[model samples]
Target: MSQAKKIMNDPENLVDETLDGLVAISNGLLAREPGSRVVRSTKIEQGKVGLLVGGGSGHEPMYGAFVGPGLANASVSGDIFAAPAPQHVQEAIEAADAGAGVLIVYGNYAGDVMNFDMGAETAEEDSDIESKTVLVRDDVATDDYEGRRGIGGAFYVVKAAGAACAKGMSLEEAAEVTERVQYNTRTIGVAVRAGILPDTGKRTFELGDDEMEIGLGMHGEVGVERSKMMTADEVAKKMVDMVADDLPYESGDRVAVYINNLGATTQMELLIVYRKVAELLAERGLKVERTDIGAHFTSQDMAGFSLTLLKLTDEIAELIDAPCESVPFTQG
Candidate 1:
């Protein structure tokens, strides 16, 4: 039995209304570009790299929350599970330009690629500004299955890009760093249940109480494999192996670990998964420099989780740890 749904309004109108709320609450630290939902930095510092990132709604602290000092200069938000309109993306690029050029980074999804491509063309209208995009297609399951899917690995890219931009790296330099990070990253996910749409009150998909889907998508798209439920440790191992195999990490390889919640999974469950992942990494003689386990990104109330790993070099490690004071992400 599903619990009753309670939202401000219907699902179709959620994105628009939420953006309104976000702007109202950002305290002028953020502002949406004219006729665009991409939150732009009010204080654009000249000669510093400008960063723009975005995706679907419901993943709150993502595309929007990461806008501020040390993060993205702008974010173009989209409807739930849908890509932002191209015009919005262009506006974001325009708003964040600070004479140093802009780096557009985002998750790898079909709609996103299409719209952002269109946005890039629109950006070229201004020859004085240079722009490039880096796509994070780190999901090992989808990466192996043919269609590239964007999952939890996006947060790491955002964090790294944000730091580089804040450090006043040239647009080309920041883009190169972002691309390198993309090549070194991998992710995998599993879902215990599906999410419900506020408007329809329906589960996005069906799964048996005793079953789970491995490699589930954020929009409730069917996963690569449906299997009998396994123990938390077993599930964690399966997830870790899926990602590690894709990277084929050699012994002693340094990495950063991100354990992202899909919405409904509890912190306690996440901790359990992390414990298994840490032990497994040690068994494989790998070193994890940073382990981030939380709701860094999410689907709408979906009961699941994903693991992302980024092979790290010294330079990338410093960028990852760089301080960011975004509304949602703040580091001392």
Candidate 2:
């Protein structure tokens, strides 16, 4: 019943306006399609396979901020927490497609799957541009692998997909690698505070002043467990336990650890949690191959974070180590 506190002019035009500002900030590396919500990067790598990713907006620096030379070629944005239309998806695919075709990487939600599939069909029919799809399913808190939803772990999957394309892999090859990369990844998140929905000015959910919800979805779906707030170390141990156990990562394994801020949580808090996460991984005898920490994917101002682990193979390690540049994510 509480209205959300936020900054803005009109919720109706928030998504488009946000894209406009994004393109402006992109320094001409990105642009919006005429009369649509599709945004594509200007720095396309010719003769290389294209990587495209999209979904609902509101998770800033996600599907949109990821467009650039080394990440997604184009991004199709929908309203906050809403799926994009198939028409717009087709537009993005056409724009992103070069001589080598586009690989569409998105989350495993039902609306996204249906719309992205329809878009792929239209793109092939209209321009003969080939496209393939890879669904990211890394949220271990969900019912099962098949029923799981992609959460913060999507960042790593996008990184792998983009790196695959940058390495000149064929569309099919990139898709295959992306699928495997996703398969090796697992994630779990906890929320201490809910995000405020821009459209209705309503908070995503409610929590007690001193309580936490474990395993909540990116969109504020109820978590599997809720309890009184605990210390950062306690939260980290529980989250890492869920993620590490879901993949059932074995001792002596090398892994990439990503700490994603759900928004509103401070960097200081994140680092504190990371220290514990690193300790936990070490206790399990897993060698931390690489560490990424920041607010890559966020839900407005939700005060929480998620931990993701990618079990590394020789091939996946190479992809993860490969350098890439984008608005929100850039690394070597």
Candidate 3:
């Protein structure tokens, strides 16, 4: 059977029911819009820039989960692996905006770009909110010079932009910082197996035993090329080298590293990637000032991982560390 029926009602109810459960456990920090899954910013303050981010639904702890003081003001949740509607994006922006304008920082998918552009238009026409967008196209697997896709590096971009907004930076400034991070960062991923969509209960793609797809996107989009699996060290070198070549960083360039888990990948595997990747950066004379390893971004239950490196500057460093207190985030 391609699709297996679930125990708790229809598969279509999974997303909404899961969100309802989240709001209950959130201690009132998260509020969903009536008739929509989009989470709104109840903590928005006047004269502060609003930040909005969203995409498909499979990536947990993203879109809505990250909404808090040091993160996104609001995040519009869409269906599993499907982009959210433009109205949801607009609602998120309007709810988060407090007259200081709004910034939409999201992945670089074509649907996201088109829908957010429409949301910006709605914000301009329906309200006094000035909106700007920063597309996160950090995936090095796709041609950066061409129509590149977005991937796990979105976590860093979100962190950087949210920190800036919390520091009272204007929408333009926050967007600028996000754009800078997007330009400085690059990501590449490898997948051992495909994910099974909850609604369908079947694999989105096929993969043979011991096979790995290099440069895979978050959604299992066709990557650089399918190849025989290699050793952890070999895979790390290939992924890191691609990023290094894509950016113009040289010796002494400071960077922050993020090793993302694309769902179902064990922490052990991620650590292996991180360890080998760090060695490559060290040999290149790159200074990795900080590192984050987690499933900050995901593609459902895909057993894969992505490596992201953001060349850092003093301004961005401070911006990323600035304090904010939100439901999902806390400051030192």
User: Number of the top candidate by lDDT?
Assistant: 2
Worst 10 residues of 1 by lDDT: 141-150
Residue pairs in collision within model 2: 4-201
Q: Write model 1 residue lDDT over 245-297, tens digit each, in one string.
A: 88788789999999998888999999988999999999988899998887777
Which lDDT value does model 2 have at 221? 91
lDDT of 3 by residue, 1-332 (tens): 35533445677787787677667767877788556767765677778898888888888877667787778778887888888888877787887787888888888788888888887798789886898888888888766444778787887788888888888888778888889888888888889988878887778778888789988877778888788888889989988899888886789999999888888889888888888988999999999998988887878788888888889999888866677655545666
Error of 1 at 171 (Å): 1.6
Against the reference, the lDDT scores of all candidates come to 0.82, 0.90, 0.81
Model 2's lDDT to the true fold? 0.90
Regarding TM-score, does 2 or 3 come out ahead?
2
Instruction: List, residue by residue over 1-332, the lDDT tens digit for candidate 2.
Output: 55467789888889988999888888888888555788888889899999889999999988778988768888889889878899999998988887899999888899999999999998899989999999988999986798788888899899889999989999989999999999999999999999989898788999999999999988999899999999999999888888888879999999999999999999999999999999999999999989999888899899999999999999999988888877777776
TM-scores, one per candidate = 0.94, 0.97, 0.94
Question: Could you give the C-alpha RMSD of every candidate to the true structure, in order shown?
Answer: 2.0, 1.3, 2.0
Clashes of 2: 1
Q: Model 1 lDDT vs. the true structure?
A: 0.82
User: Residue 76 lDDT in model 1?
Assistant: 87
Judging by TM-score against the true structure, name the best candidate. 2
